[model samples]
Target: MKIDDWLLEILACPACKSPLRAESEELACTSCGLIYPVRDDIPVLLVDEARKPS
Candidate 1:
């Protein structure tokens, strides 16, 4: 829930290269709307591991 601003600034959606915004325990894509999980404060950015946009 609390990712560093600098890190967040560099994170992008693997699907669409869109910016990611921290949401709960996941990162939501701004373009494709993919939801990537965050575990132990590390982001899981694999496209296959992302949740479908809802």
Candidate 2:
């Protein structure tokens, strides 16, 4: 999954408005313990759809 650098730069966690770091196939919030999934290169940033850090 590839998201544009510019877009990723501006993308933040919907939950805590924290910066996100690109992981295998997800984006992890730096502040909150939320892991957002990337489906078909699209970041699923919905808070309800986020997975709590394990």
Candidate 3:
């Protein structure tokens, strides 16, 4: 699912508090490289739920 531009603009990484960029079906942290999943169009910002950058 695609996240809205406005929401993507405000969404931050729960771990590093850095800005996130929409990537396909996930929101990836620009700073810390944590990949947050977008489930049902809702961003799962939990640090435990995030995937480490590969």
Candidate 4:
């Protein structure tokens, strides 16, 4: 499922409050290197749920 364009534009990274770029099924924060997964079209922005950069 795809997030709305406006919503995507407004969504920010919960960790560093940086803008997120849309990936295949996740939103990635370029600044902090956090990958937030989208579950059922809903973005899980919680820091605890984010994946760390390898």
Candidate 5:
């Protein structure tokens, strides 16, 4: 499922404790520049699995 607008208010970056925005299929943290993947309708909010900024 897609991330709901209300969920954005509570979802924070697991790495930097920063705010996150819903990208195409992931959650992107502007502060840390990390992209957390969304798989099987679940957000994989893990730093180790997150994509590094390019």
Candidate 6:
């Protein structure tokens, strides 16, 4: 199952305490420009997997 809105409520960026938006197959933190990938509908909120800002 995918990470629901309830789960998102408690999810914060590891680098910065910012809200995230659902991107294509990932959750992106707008403030820090971190992209948290989602695998099998599960959000991988890891700093290593996060994409750096362009």
Select the stronger candidate by TM-score from 5 and 6. 5
lDDT of 5 by residue, 12-37 (tens): 99999999998888889979889999
Query: TM-scores of all models?
Result: 0.91, 0.92, 0.92, 0.92, 0.88, 0.80
- Give me the runs in candidate 1 sitting further than 4 Å from their true place: none
Go through the candidates in order and give each one's C-alpha lDDT: 0.92, 0.91, 0.89, 0.92, 0.88, 0.84
* Model 6 lDDT per residue over 1-54, tens place: 367888887888888989888876789896888988888998888898888866
lDDT, candidate 3, 1-54, per-residue tens:
867788888888888888999889998999999998888989999989989988
Give the TM-score (vs. native) of candidate 4.
0.92
Clashing pairs in 4: none
Please identify model 4 stretches exceeding 4 Å from their true place. none
Residue 13 accuracy (lDDT) in model 6: 88
Q: Write the per-residue lDDT of candidate 2 for residues 1-54, one digit (tens) a residue.
A: 799889899999887898899988999999987999999999999999999999
Q: What are the RMSDs of all candidates, in order?
A: 0.9, 0.7, 0.8, 0.8, 1.1, 1.7
* lDDT for 38 (candidate 3): 83
Q: How close is candidate 3 to the true structure, as a TM-score?
A: 0.92
Error of 5 at 13 (Å): 0.5
